[model samples]
Structure formats: C-alpha cells, structure tokens
Target: MVAPMGYLPQLMYGALITLGVALSAVLFGAAFGLLGAMAKLSASRPLRAVAEAYTIVVRGTPDLIIILIVFFGGTIALTRLFGRTVEVSEFGAGVASLAFVFGAYATEIFRGAIRAVPVGQIEAARALSLPAPILFLRIVLPQAWRVALPAFGNQSIILLKQTSLISVVGLEELMRSASMAAGATREPFKWYLAAACLYLVMTGLSTILLRLAERRANLGYERR
Candidate 1:
C-alpha cells in the first residue's frame, strides 16, 4: 500500500534534505580524500604517518558512533576549546560526520589508484625535469581518476545510503520523516515500506551512474 497523500510533501522534502546532505558530504570528502591520498604517498614520514592514523581511526569506528560523537561530543569539545558558546546545526553535523567517514574510505581508493600509476611514468617525467605539480596534473591525475572511479563511485553510493543515520541526530531525512508519519498515522508498515522504496530508488540511480562512469573510464583499455 502507498503512503497517505498527506505524507507526500513531507517525504519529498525529506528526500531533498537527504540529497543535499549527501552532496555536501561528498564534495568535502572528495577534497579530503585527495589530500589524504597525496599525504599517504608523500616521501615525508610524518605526512604518511598522519594520513595512516586518520584512516585507521575512522575505519576502526562504527559510522553511527561517529555521528553521535560528532553531534553530541563535538559540541562539548568545541565549547571547551573555544571558550565561547558554539552550536552546530544537525544538518551540518550530519554532513561533517559523514564526510569524515566517507573521506577515510576515499583515501584508500585514491591511494590505491595513485599506486597503480606506473612508477616508470613518474620517473620519466622527473627525468624530463618537469615540475612535480605539472607531472601530476598532466600525467598522473588523469589516470588516477580513471583507476579510482569504481571505488569512488562505490563510496559515493555508500555515503548516500549512510545519510539515513543522520536521523538519529534529529535531522528529518526520509527515515525520520517516515517514522514521524508512521507514528502519527499508526500505519508503520506503509510508511516504512515507502522509506525503503525511496532508498532503493536512490540506490538504483546511483548504480546506473556508476556503471556509466566505469564504462567511460575503461574505454581506452578495452581490447579489440
């Protein structure tokens, strides 16, 4: 059975919020992931150590625990350090929490991609006396992005689904909105099914996009 007509607006609005949060997190996460990947591959020991530590801590913890720490513990930590009142929006906290988690996974994907780049190519660039930035920009990043696409796409889809965890912090995404509707209408089955279908729709679209990206990235590598 479908959700009541009255719940349509709420469900749509919640979906929009979910999309917004996922986008924000993914953007920041990509940036952080790139930086982390570079750091992990850097010659500097301290940089590598820091990058590894960050990945270890994030991957070692549960995502829901991270969200709670960011939403609740973050406030306490910030207030103490800043010596002033600090408040973060539930949406912002959700975005930040998910971004950090997403970034950790993305870092591994990017690092692997970077490693897959032929060392000889980098050596060739160095022999030609190309600046490091130029070598990376003109040669390294293109191939790395292609190599990373599948893993990045996977992370993106995971992050999108993970947005549901934000509801615990009281940001009214699809799950929270559906829960409220179910409570109000006393029809848990319908609203919950609606939420599940909405999530499946999002996942389906992401799957299609990822497949397209993979095909595009692998075009040059296809054998005749």
Candidate 2:
C-alpha cells in the first residue's frame, strides 16, 4: 500500500478524467473517420477533395497548434455567434481538438483497411446480388475492423499520452494536477514521477487489451 500524501488522491482523480477524455475523443474521432473514409472512397469528386483537404491539413499541423486553435477559436466563434462572451471549457476544447486530429489519421487507417479487404470477396458479394449495405455489414466491415485494429490501437495510445497536453489549457488532468501538487510541495520530481507512472499504467493496460482484441480479431485467420 502506498502512503497517502500530497494530492495523490487528486492526481488519481485527474488521471481518471484523462482516461475519460481520451476515450470520448476516440469515439467521436471514429465517427468522423468513418464518414471521412467514405467520402474519400466515394465516386463524388467534391467529397473526395474535401476529405483529402481535411486529412492533409490536419496531418500536417502539430497537435498542440490544433488544440490551441480549437480552444481559442471555439470561444471566439461562439462569442461572435451569440453576440456575447462565451467560454469554452478545457474538457470540451481538448476532446474536440484531439478528436479532430485523431479523425484525420483514422480516416487513412480506415481507408487503407477497407482497400485491404480482398477484392474477390466484394466481387462474389456482388455476384450474389447482396445489397451494398448488407454486403458491407456482413463482409467488408469485419475484415476492415481486423485490418484497422492494430493501427487504431497505436493511435489510441498516442491519444492517451496527448491528453497531457490538455494541461496547457488548465484542464485538471493528471499533468496539470501533478504540476500543481509539485509546485505546492516543492517536489517536482516526485509528483511528476507519480504522474508518469499513472500514465504508463494506463498505456500498459491499453496495450494488453489491444493485444487481446487483436487476437480475437484474428481468430478466423488463425483457424484457416
């Protein structure tokens, strides 16, 4: 049992919040990615261009810049729209920015995964006269899910670490909490070390879960 001291409890709470934010961002990002991937793969030229522009811009920019943009830009936009002062909270801004970045990468991941699906299967499905929706739900999505899992897991882990950046906006996630505690206690190394350990624990757990998921996703492949 660890000795109770110096805002460890608060830091733990903050870590939980960090996890929640990362997860929420990933969920939202996945939705954005699915649409973006569809647009990229679609026959429509304008949609493909729009999706191309989104990925290129987002991928080229730094995550920190994006965070700042979402944080300050959202507040400004909201205030202008409402004709009054509007403050965007750190949590909302952080999640939205992170989701935006994550979606850009995820769009590529999903697109690649979809492309990786065996073309022969799609031809067979068409030959069988399966509706496009049914074909995707029954066949394409499962293989894409498997192919995308490894990349998705890596992206999730990166997003988890990036949660620390939210500290700059004053969200009381682990990094911010540790910074405050370290300052108050004048023990920067100790508090920051604790924060690092907590992050490692979270990432380690995520890695393990991801491996398990990968194994499950590969079960059919193994059997064959």
Candidate 3:
C-alpha cells in the first residue's frame, strides 16, 4: 500500500519527537527511581511504606490510565491550588506519566541490584574509614550499576514504546503522525506498518547501544 507522497518527512519528524520524549522520560525516571530505591531501603518504616505503595500502585495500574490521571487530574489539582487555569502540554503529561511508571519498575531493579552487592565489601569499605558518600560511590554504586544495567536497558525499551500513549493526549509523535496520516490517506495498513518499522529500528539501535554499555560496565570482571 502506497502512503501519501508528502507524508514521509512528517513521519520522520514525528519519529524524532518520539525519540526525544523517550530519552527525556528515561532521565527523569532514573532520578525518581534512585530516590525511590533509597527510600525503600531506608530504616524508617514510613519511608519504606511510601516507596512500596508508590511502586505497587503505579505498577498495578495500566499505563494509559496513569497517563490520563496524571494529565487531567494533575491539571485540575494545580489549577485549583493556584486559583487559576493550569494547562499541561501533551509532552509534559507524557514524560511525567512514563517517568513515573518507569521509576516504579526501576526502583525494584535498583533495590535488588543494591542488595546483590556483597555486604562484606561495604563492611570492608567502612573499615577503611571511607566516608559514607565515598563508600557508596566508590564501592556500592559501581557494582550495583553493573547488576542493574540489563534490567534498566529493558525498562528503557519499554519506556520508548510507551511514548505512543502520548498520542491520546494529542502529542504529534510517531504514532500520532501515522494515525493522522492514515485518517487522511485512507491507508491505515501502510502508515501503521511504517510506524512499526520505525519503532523496530529504534529498539534495534537501542539494544546495540545497551549491549555496548553493559560490556563497558562489566570491564575488569572475570568473564563467565
């Protein structure tokens, strides 16, 4: 099926937007994930409970529902709080919701990775009189990062795909562009297939880069 003659450029632009949104969301998600993981690991029961609840609630709900609630509900709440209209852009809503979802998953990934690091190593670092920050940065984080890389990469791919949900909020991302083109051209199969191919390319490239990152992270370790 032939797509409309002038649609490819628009679609490509949309794909770029999708990439930008995915990257931005991942960064935000990583920040949230680190905080959540620390909170969950804290000695304080209330902090642990809050982190647990965040992960359970976000992970249990559908991504689309989260997007809608954050976008619409947040907008309403902000408007009411400020006593004025508050508008949330599709991009903002998309990033916030996806980041939140990604963070929940990442929290578990990071927490498990942190736990996997040898407790003896931490004890040894403390015995050397290393500052807490130095001990964490020099000893704990490097090992934990190696353990977390694979899961984090997987979550990143999932986050990339989730950007499609932004279309519902009127974002002109790849899926939205393909949808609009399909409506206008009456060639749903062609446009949709194109979008799928684009997504495949993005994920494929991402996999290669992530594998390289994993190898780099594994440096100095004995190969199995």
| Top-TM-score structure, candidate number | 3
The order by descending TM-score is: 3, 2, 1
Ranking by lDDT: 2, 3, 1
Global lDDT of each model? 0.91, 0.95, 0.94
C-alpha positional error of residue 151 in candidate 3 after TM-score superposition, expressed in Å: 0.8
lDDT by residue for model 3 (134-190), tens: 998899899999999999999999899989999999999999999988988989999
Give the count of colliding residue pairs in each prediction.
0, 0, 0
The ten-residue window of minimal lDDT in model 2 covers 1-10
User: In candidate 1, how many Å is residue 6 off?
Assistant: 1.0
> Lowest lDDT 10-mer window, candidate 3?
1-10
Which numbered prediction scores highest in lDDT against the true structure? 2
Error of 3 at 208 (Å): 0.3
TM values, all candidates: 0.93, 0.95, 0.96
TM-score comparison, 1 vs 2, better candidate: 2
lDDT of 2 at 158: 98
RMSD value for candidate 3: 1.9
